[model samples]
Target chain A: MSYSILVVDDSPVIRKMMKRSLSLSKLELGTVYEACNGQEALVVLRREWIDVVLADIHMPVMGGTELIEAMSKDPELSKIPVVVVSAERNAQAIAHLKTLGICAHLTKPFTPEQVLHAVDDVLEQVAQRSVA
Target chain B: MSQVLLAGPLGEVTKSVLSEAAFLFCDELSEGAAPLEARLVEATITFEGATPGRITLRLPWHVACEAAANLLGAEPGDDDVEANAHAAVGELLNMISGSALERWFGSGSQWSLGLPSVSEREGRLPSSAPRGELVALAIDDARIELEASLGSVT
Candidate 1:
């Protein structure tokens, strides 16, 4: 199934990288949206049908953690799986993000294979949740 | 002391990150060989928590183009290469700062990263930084400099 995804980062270059990585890996993708920060990501989520979110933690206006927190509080947005694509190295912070119910964490400098695998993993969880 | 501890991981992290993200191969430059020119762009990301400091990355114009091209999956000569280089440098520094902080300060530490900034004007290291190191890396036959210093600079 094709998935509609949102990539959120302050850097346009990194956002473009995510698109290239997904296309190069041949992952099934529907309409892919881009946002510069979490606040913009929220607007996209409201307007589009997104299945997954890829985000960076350091950003202007809003950050990944704050975005996740906002998503968690919203019923519809909460259902959409978030896969963090970040440069976060703090162990506690990563663990904290996990507590918020992120599907996966892919560190920066990640490969296309990693992205495919992470997204696939999130999809599997969605499938299982539906089955349950 | 801090310099000896940090220089290795900073170089190793830079090599790994650039290799994967930008498809750039990096080698450490010998000290005192030649200074990196000021024409390069510099990106800085600061972190605050248990340890407060900043990581500054300098990218040669050509290497920035290569990184932007690789990230965007475009040819190095593409017209958009120059436009994307600034963001590419910032993102690279963001990754380096996060990875380096985790290794240096431990994983459980709480650190908040600042929004990355890119510019031609370089930042001076803080005087409060008791010890720090500057790492020079060669990528695509061009030199990029990285300076990791402790304490915050205003």
Candidate 2:
């Protein structure tokens, strides 16, 4: 089945790159949504049927931390997996992301294989969770 | 830590990030051979936590176009690449700063990377950032400079 995805980041170039990487890869994809910040992402998450989210941690208005926190608090949104794609390298920052319940973290300048691998891993987890 | 300590990691980080993330190739520039074009743009980002500091990146206008085009798989002069040049440079600054911070400090060091701000200006480094240590590189056949100014380490 194709998976609908949401990509949240302030940089237009990054957003475009992420989309290109996904579309060119072997993953089965559906509609891809874009948001400028965590706040905008929240709006999209609430309205759309998203399978996963690839987000950046720092942005104007709201950030990935805030978005993840909001999702964890909500029952429905919490079920969808998140893969953080960011420039964050601090261990503490990454640990904080783990505690917030993200499935994976890929540092920026990531290769398409890395992105596809992370997405595939998360999607597999979702499938297994459904089977159980 | 001081800029002297950061100098090594800065050089390596810029090269790897440009090559891996931006799809741009770069090499450390030889002294006294720096040639910057008439147009340039700077992207600056600030980080806080164990070490608070600012990292600034300067690129020739044409180099920015090359970076954007590479990132987007478009031609350098393509309209989309031209428009995305600023954002591409800003994102590159973010990646370099994030990697450099971890390599300079410990990986477990607590810190928050800031968003990069980009602006177009004419020629060379700006009047600000006198205390910032600079790293020069030859990228896309143009001079690219990076500077880092660190605050008191906590």
Candidate 3:
């Protein structure tokens, strides 16, 4: 079945590139949504029925950390998985992200295949969680 | 460390990112090669922490367009590529800065990377700028410059 997804980042170029890369994924993809930052992403998550979220940290207004934190606080939002795509390389920062409940992390300069793999991996975990 | 010493890591990170992210390969320009004399797009990013510094990238407009197109897997003439050439350069700098910082300090260290800013620049590209140039590259039909100016790190 096809799945809807949301992409959150402050850079339009990155947002555009991620959208293009998502299309390259062999998954049965549905409508892909976009947001400029966490504040905007929250609004979309509240209104849309997105199956997964691919987000970037280090954004203005709000960042991926706060977005994930907000989602974790909400019972319904927390169920949907999040995959972080970012340029962050700090060990502590990445570890901090793990504590926030992100399903997967993909560093910058990733290939479209890499993005697909991340999406697939997270989706698989969600499927397993539902099965058990 | 001085700019001359730090440029090595900066160049290494730049080549790696450009090759992977933009599907472009590059090499360090030799000492004798003619300097890059052309209109260019300059992108800069800052790292704040114990050692605050800035990284800048400068490349020709065509190269920027090509990079944007390649990153999106689109043609250079596409509307999206034309509109985002500056932004493409900026993001490229951002990626380069993140890795460069990691290499300079330990990956486990703490540092905050700022958003990249892009602008237009024109001049002859030397091996190093007054602030500091990590390296110069020959990519396709253009020359690209990577620079970093940082605080004292002994």
Q: Of the candidates shown, which would achieve the greatest DockQ relative to the real structure?
A: 2
List model 2 lDDT by residue over A51-115, tens digit each: 99999999999999999999999998998899999999878888999999999999998887888
Clashes of 1: 1
DockQ for candidate 1, please give it: 0.83
Q: Supply candidate 2's per-residue lDDT for B80.
A: 95
| Model 1 spans with C-alpha error above 4 angstroms | A25-27, B36-38, B121-132
Query: What DockQ would candidate 2 receive versus the native complex?
Result: 0.90
DockQ: the better of candidates 1 and 2: 2
Which of 2 and 3 is ahead in lDDT?
2
Q: Which has the higher lDDT value, candidate number 1 or candidate number 2? A: 2
Model 3 residue A59 lDDT score? 86
lDDT for position B145 in model 1? 74
Residue-level lDDT tens digits of model 1 in B1-154: 2556888888998898889778899976655655444457778878888768878887877778888898888999988889988888888888888888878877877888788889864423222243357777777557777888876556
- Score chain A of model 2 by TM-score against the reference chain A: 0.97
Of the true interface contacts, the fraction found in model 3 is: 0.79
Per-residue C-alpha lDDT of model 3 across residues A39-75, encoded as one tens digit per residue: 9999999999999999999788999989999999999
Better of 1 and 3 by TM-score: 3
Candidate 3 lDDT for residue B22: 91
